[model samples]
Target chain A: MKTRYHIRPRHNIRPQSCIYALLASISVAVFSLPNAAHAAGTLAGTDIQNVASATFDTAAGPVTIQSNTVTIKVDELLDVTVSSTDPGDVITSPGQTSNVQRFRVSNTGNGDEAFALTATVANGGDDFDPSLQQIVIDANGNGVFDAGVDVVYTAGVNEPVIAPDQNITVFVITSTPAGVVDTNRANVSIVAAAVTGTGAPGTSFANAGQGGGNAVVGPTGAQSSASGFLAVQATSVTLNKTATILDPFGGNRPVPGAIVTYSLVATVAGTGLLNNLVITDPIPVGSQYQPASLTLEATALTDAADADAGNFNGTRISVAAGNVPAGQTRTVTFKVLIP
Target chain B: MKLIIRIMMAFATLTGASLAVAATPLQLSSDVFVERTIEGVDGTKTVVLEKPKMVTPGDSLVFVVKYKNVSATTATNFVVTNPLPPAVAFNGTSDGQEIVSIDGGKNWGFLGDLRVAKEDGATRAAQRSDVTHIKWNLNQPLTAGAEGKLIFRGVVK
Candidate 1:
C-alpha cells in the first residue's frame, strides 16, 4: 500500500511535530472502527477514505484550521474465485483414467495472484472410494484433454498466476479402483488459495510471504474452492430357463399331446438395473402354447393377447418384465402341449 | 484436511428393552451419493446406478449416517448433529421430523417454524438455504445388536 500516511508540517517545529503525531494517531482511530481481520498480509476489499477539519481561534477573532484529507488505497489488491463447471462428472469402470470434469479459476480481485492447488477424495457420504484421482490443466489449449496432451497440476512457487477477471479451465482426472461395485461413489474436492507477497518463489501458506497487502481470509473479499465426485456404475444380469415334460402314460417323455411346463427366470448378478424388459421365446416346433396356462410366479393371467398373460404371436411367446433391480429376479412360467 | 468418515450399519433383532445412552454402546458412520436416472434393458425407465462421484452444480447428495449398537445393552435419548459443509447448500433432510439449525447450531427448528434476520434487520420465515446443521433424536431405543440408519440431503454449491 502507498506508505501509510503521517501528518507532517513543511517547517521543523519542536512542539508542532508532537501535534502532527496526534493528527496521524486520530486518523488511525477513525478507520480502525471496524477491524478488517484479514487472514494474513493479504489486502483486498473496501478501501479507507477520509478527510479531517479542525476549527480554532487564530490571530483574528475566530479562524478555521482545516488540514488536507489524505486517502489510503490498496494497490496490489487480492481477490480470486475457483469452481468446477462440470460439477458431477462420472467415471466407474476400474483402471480407466480419463478427464471427467473441468474447473475454472479466475483472479477477480485487483492485482495478480498465484493460486496454490490441491485435491481430496471426499469428506464422506460416498458409496465407493476414488481409486486414483489427479488434477490436470489443458496444456495444448484444446478444450479436450488428449492423452499425453495435458499437464498435471502441482502446487508451489511458479504456480499459474492470473490477472484480474482472467480465468483458466483445468481437468479433474480419475480412475475407479478394481472391484468397485455399482452405487459406489467417490467425491473429489479441489482448492486454489491465493499466493501473494515477496520472497515469492518458496514462500507457502506457512511462512507465506505477505500477499495483497493483507493476510489470507483477512476481513476480505474472496476465496475460491471447487469440489465434486465420480460415481461407479456397472450392471450385470443373467437369465435361467428350464423345461419339464409329462406323457399321457404318467411317464416323462416328449410325446404328442403331452404337456410341458417351461420356466424362465431373469436375475441380475451384481449391482445394476435393467428397465423395460420384454422377454420373448419362440414357440417350440410341433408344440402348442396353452393360452390360459401362463403364470407370472403365482398370478394367472387371461389367455387373451392383450392381458398380463403370456402372449403367443402364432410362433413367438412374449412377456413384459417392467424392471429388474440388482439381485432381484422375476420368473415367468407357462405350459405347452405337443402337437 | 478433509476427513472421509465411514459409517457402518448393523441390524440387531433384539427388541422390547429400553436402555439409556450411558448403558448402551453405539457406533456411527456416514457416506454420500448422488441419484441419477437412466434407461433400462426392459425398454422402460431405469436407474443408472450413478453412485457417488464427481458432482456438478445442482446435484443432490444423499448423506447416510449408519449407526449400530456395538455394545451389549440397548440405548436411548441419542442425538446426532451434522454440520453442513461450506460448499454445500442444505436443500432438505431425509428425516422430515428432524430439526435443523441455520444459525450455526445456535438455534434450531423446522423450516416453516424458523425465521432469519435479513440485512434490513427484519426477521422473516427461514428458507432451506438457511439450514446449517441437522439434528436427529431417535424416537425409539436402539437395542443392543441392532443396526439402522439416518439420512439427510444437500446440494453442492
Candidate 2:
C-alpha cells in the first residue's frame, strides 16, 4: 500500500515542515483505520503483525518510511511426561522378570527437544526394589520388549530428539531378588528433562518460564516423573458347579433329556486390583447350557452371548466380571439341558 | 444435475469453513487443575495435583485458561469463555471479583445479579448448577511474548 501526497510546492511553506505533518497524519490514519472485523480479526483469531514501509516521490526525494519492527516470537513450551498401565501391579516371580511393564515418555513441547532420561526408586510405600534395572526402547513401536529386536537405551549423550506431541515407548525391565514371595512389592520410576537449548546432559535451568508463562522449578513442563509399582500379587477366582435333575414324569432321574441346574461360585483372592475379569465355563459334552436359565446372584440374564453382561453362548457361558477387588466372590448360576 | 452438483460442492466448502473458524489460533485453551489442602494429624499441607485421574467430592480445583497472542500482531478484544466441567460447580468469584461470569456470558455482574427461571413461572436466584459457563473480559491487549492464566476455583459437584 502506497500513499502519494501533492504539496502544491508553496514558496512560503517550508517543504520539511509540510512533509513531516503530512507523514505523521498518514501514519495515524493507517493505524487508526477501524480494526479488522470481529470474525475476520481478533474474534476469529486471524491476525498477523508486520512492519510497513512507505515511499513518496515528492519535491524532496524518494524517502523510505520506517516503523517499529514487530518480530514474531512464539513461546517454546516443553512438556515431557511418562505414563504406565500397571493396572494390577502384579509382582514378579523369582527367576521370572519376563513380565514387561511399558512406560512411555513423550515430548509434548512445541519444538523438537532432547530430554535427559533417568530412572530411580521412590521410597514411600511397602515396596521392594528391582535387583537389576534395564531400560529399552520399543524399536518396532509394537509396545513389546523383544530382546533381540529392541535395543537398550544408553544413558546420557546421544539421547533421541523427540518431536512435539511425539512419544517413544520404553520398557522398565526389572529382575526380582533371589528370594521372592507373594507379599513382596517393588516400585520403579522414570524421569525425563529437556536438554534443548542446554549444551550438555547435566545442564540445569533456574526460574524458567513454561509455555503458559508459569515459572516452574525445572526448565519447563519439559520435565516429568512417573513411578510404577511392581508388586507380588495374583488373583484367584473359584467356580463351583451344581446340578439338579428333573425327569419328564416329575421324578428326579437322568433320562434322555432333562434339566440340570449348575452353580458357579467365582471368588477372587489377591493383593492388587483385578480388572477385566471374564469367566467362561464350557458346557459338558453330554449337556448344553440353556440360554434362558442363566441367573447371576438370582438376577435373570439373557442367554445369548453378548445379550447382556452375562452371556451364554451355544457351547459355553461367558460373563464379564470387571474390577473384582481383593477377597471378593461373585456367583453365577445357570441351567443346562442333558441331550 | 450440474446445478445440483455445484450446490453440493458449495455446501461442503461452507461446512468445512465453519468448522475451521472455531479453531482459530488466537483462541485460548482452557483446562482444569485440581489441588487440595489435606488436613493431616501432623499439620496442613497443600499438594499440587499431577495427572488427576480421580477426584473425590468436596475437593476444589482451579480452572485456568492459557491465553497467548498467537498472531504476529497484538491481539485486542481478549475474552475467554471457560465451561465448568460436568463434575464440578462454580464456587464463587475467586480473584476478588476481578473476573465474574455467573450468567452464561450475557452480562458481567455479581453473583446476586445472576438469576434463573423456576418451575413456578418466576425468576429466582441461580444455583451453582446453573453456572453454565464463565467468561473473562481481559480488557487488555495480548501482545507478543504475552502468556498468562485466568483462573477460578471450582468445587466438585
Candidate 3:
C-alpha cells in the first residue's frame, strides 16, 4: 500500500499557520495506515502531530490562544526471523537424491527489505554429511518441492524482497551418499540477513530505509538462521508363499483334476519406505492356470493389466505392491487346476 | 455582574477600535521530545530529553505546552486543552489534576471515572488508548508576565 502525505503550501503564511492547514488537510487525505495486526507495529515515515490550546477569561472578554503544531517522523526498523518447518527428521533411503528440508524466513521489520539467503550442509553435529545442492524457493507457496517449477537462489541475483511481517518458504535440497548407515542423521541449515546491512541492535544506517528514512537494527540484529535434519533409513520387502489342494471326490491330495489354491504374502521390514515393490508367482508346469481366480487379499483381479493392483501375463501373475512402508504387509492369492 | 462579553478561538483579533494594538495577552507554544536513559560509569542512570530527529513506533515521547501572560493585567479561569494525535497513545501524566476525554471532547473526567462502550453493548473501563483529549484547569490566576508549563507523556503507535 502507498502512503500519501498532504503537505500544505508554505509561502507567506507563518510556520504555525501552515502546520495547522496541513493538519486539517491531512484528515481529508486518503492515508492507508499499515495493517494493525502486523507484528512490525507501524509504518515508517508516519508523521505524528500534536497541538494544544488555552482559553482564559480577561476583564475585557474571554481570549483563546493556539499553540504551535509539533510534528515528528517515524523511522524504519530492520529485523528478520528464520525457523524450520519440518515436522521431524525427514526420513530418506540410502543413496536417495532430491531430499529436501523446509524452512521459512520472515521479515519482521517496519519497512520493506531485501534478504540474502544462504544454505550449508557442513554442520558437524550429524552422523553423515549430505552433499548440499542449490536452495530453491516455493514459488507457488504450496510447501512442496517441485523441480523446474520453483526458483533457485543466487547470491546478489534475485534475492527475495519481503514486505513488513511477510514470510517466504525455502527448501534446502541435498543428496545422501550411497554407503551411509541406517538411522544416521545429517543437518542442513539456512541463514537469512537483511541486504541493506546487519549489526548490533540500535545500529543506524542513514537514508537506507524505505521512504529514505534512517534504518535502525532491531532486537534480531537483522539476521537469523535455522537448521533442519535428514535421517537415513534402510528398508526391504519379503514375500512368502503357501499352497492348498483338493481332489474332486477324495481327501486333499495332489491328484488329477485337483484344484490348487496358492497364497503369497509380502511383508516389509525396517524404518524406511520400500518403493515400487512387486510380487509375482508362476503356475506349475503340469497344471493349467485358472482364469478369474486371482485375488489380492481376497479381492478378485482381472487377467488383463487394468486399473487394479494384480494382473496376469499368460506366464505368471504379477501384483504391483507400490510403496510399502516399514512394518506393513500385503497378501496376494491365485489358483490353478491339475491336468 | 461578571459577564464574558466575547470568546474568540482564532488569532485573537479585535475590531471597531484601535486594531493596531490588538494582540492576545497570552502566548501558547508546543514542543515534543524523545527521552533516552543514559547510564553513567558509576552505575547511575539519568533520563535525558532530546529533540526527535529519528523516532519509531513503540518509542516513548514527552510533550510540553507552555503558556505565559504577557499583558499588564492578570489572566483568570485559564484552561489548557490538548487533542491527542491519532498516531500516539496517551501515557499517564505526572500531574494529578489532568482530566481526559474518551469521546471526542464530549465527556470529560478523570481516567478512573470514565467508562467506554464495547461493541457488545456493554460498558467497560477506559484505557489509555481510549483517551482522545487531555485538559488541565488552572484555578490559580496567572499574574503579569507569569509563565508555566504542562507536561504529559505518550508512546508512538
Candidate 4:
C-alpha cells in the first residue's frame, strides 16, 4: 500500500518548479537572517579620531588648549586637530647682566603631536631697544648656545615642528652698549601646533574601520606666554668742593683768615635714569655766596660749558645734564671761596 | 506574525524612551558679591578713594566694583552711582560709564556737557569727571546667579 501511494502523488510537478522553490527558500532565509553586523561595519567608516584637549607649561604659568579636534567622515573629506604647548614659568631679575636668558619649550601631550614653536617678544612697548638688546634666535631652546652654534630663521619659517614629549630652548641676550638701560619688562609668547594623524593606537577601532582610513589630520595650534622685567639702577653721585680766601685782614696774624675746603656727595639709591636732575646746597646764612672762583667736576658732564652758571657763583649749584647708568657711580668736584 | 509585531513595537518604544532621556537640559547655579567702603585722610574724611587702597601721587589707581544677581528673576535697568573724590584728577575713560560732576557731585551730567580748564589756561570739553566713584547704568537684565564687574581709573594726588 505504501508503494502504490508513493507513485501517485506527483502528477505534473516540473523539475523547473522544484528548482524555483529551492531558490525562493534560500532568498527568504538570506533576507530573514540579521544584517546588523553589516550595518555596524558600514557605520565604522564614519567614526573619526580627534584630540579633545592639550596642555603645556609656560613662563607665564600653566597654559592649556581645549577641544580643537574636528570630526571628518569619508564623505566629508576634511578633518582638523588643534593643539598647543605653553612655555612654563619664566624668571628674570632686574638688571640681569647675562647676554641671554634661556627658556625651555616642551610638549605634554600623550598623542605624538607635531607642533611649530615660535617666540615673539613685545619688548614691553618698545621698552627695549632692539639694537641695544639683541634678540638672537637660538634654534635649540637651551640658553647656553653660542653664536656659532645657534641658527636663526625668518618669521613663520623660523618655527620648528616639535614632536610630543620633545622640547627646545631659546635665549634672550642683552647687547653691550655702554649706557644701555633695561628698565621695562618684556613679554615672550611661544605657540605650538599639533600634527594630524589617525587616533592613538587603541581608539581607532571604536568607530569601526570606516573612521581609521580616509581622514585628513591637520595641526592644532596653541600658545604660551611669559613676562620679564628689566631695571637700570644708578648707584651713586659724588660732589667735591674746594674753598679759598683772598688776603683777608691783610696781616700775618695767621693771615687773619683760613682756607676752607668741603666736599658734597649724593648717591642715588634706586633704579632709573634721573632726568632734568638738579642738586643744590645753598650757602649757610652765615656764609656769603662766592662767585668767579668756583670749579666743578662731574663724570656725566661732557664739557665745562654743560655746567650751569649757578654752579659757580650763585647760592645753588646745578649740573645741567647727568646720566647714571645701571650699577654705576658718578662724581662731581667744585671749588668755592669764603670772603 | 502578531507576536513578532508586538516585539518590534516594544523595541521602538524603548529606543524612544532612551532618546528622550538623553535630551534633558542641565541646570547650573552661581553666586556673586560686592562691597564698597570709603576712607578719608582721617578715619572720617569725606573723600572716598575710588579704591580702598593708598595710592601715590602720580600712580594710576583703578577702582572696580562687582555685583551678582542671586534671585531667580533677572534684575532689569539697574543703576549705580559713584561720587568723585576732591583730591583725584580725572583722565579720559572708555566704555559705557560717564564722567559728570557739577557743583561737587550735587548734580550729575554727561561728561561731554562739562567744561574743564587746562594748565596753559586753555579750556577744553571735559570728557570724564574727576572720578571719586563710579556708576553703572545697566540696560540689560542681569540673569539669576549672574555676576559682573565695572572698572574705572584716575590719578591719585
At residue A226, give the lDDT of candidate 1.
73
lDDT of 4 by residue, A1-339 (tens): 111100000001011244433422332233223221211011112212121111222223322222222222221111122222223322233444444545555543222233344445545464443222434455655556578678653445555444334456655554323354334444444433332333332222222222233322212223343343333433444544443344455432223243333345445444555444455565544444444433334332222334353343345555543565434443444433343
Local accuracy by lDDT, each model: 0.56, 0.54, 0.78, 0.37
Q: Which pairs of residues collide in model 2?
A: A49-B73, A78-A222, A91-A231, A91-A232, A128-A185, A238-A267, A240-A265
The segments of candidate 4 whose C-alpha lies over 4 angstroms from its true place after superposition are: A1-99, A110-114, A123-142, A156-158, A172-183, A195-221, A234-258, A262-266, A272-339, B1-157
How accurate locally is residue A2 in candidate 3, as Cα lDDT from 0 to 100?
19
Tens-digit lDDT track of model 4 for B1-157: 3323433653553354345333312111111111224556678745333322211223344444445554465544444343333223355344656535543444456776666666788977754433333344556655767776555554432
Which parts of model 3 have CA positions greater than 4 angstroms off?
Answer: A1-38, A140-150, A237-268, A276-324, A328-339, B1-22, B40-43
lDDT for model 1, on a 0 to 1 scale? 0.56
- What CAPRI-style quality would you assign to candidate 3? acceptable
TM-score of candidate 2 against the unseen true structure: 0.35
Better of 1 and 4 by lDDT: 1
Regions of model 1 farther than 4 Å from truth: A1-60, A76-181, A184-225, A246-257, A269-272, A285-287, A301-309, B1-157
Candidate 3, residues A19-92: lDDT per residue as tens digits? 33443233212121322344675555556777676777778766666677687766788899999999999987
Chain A TM-score of prediction number 3: 0.64
TM-score of each: 0.38, 0.35, 0.72, 0.29
Q: In candidate 2, how many clashes are counted?
A: 7
lDDT of 3: 0.78
lDDT for each residue of candidate 2 in B1-157, tens digit (9 for 90 to 100): 3323433653553354346335433434445555755667889675775433323334466655555544455655455544343334567555644433444345555566767666678988766545645555566666765777666766643
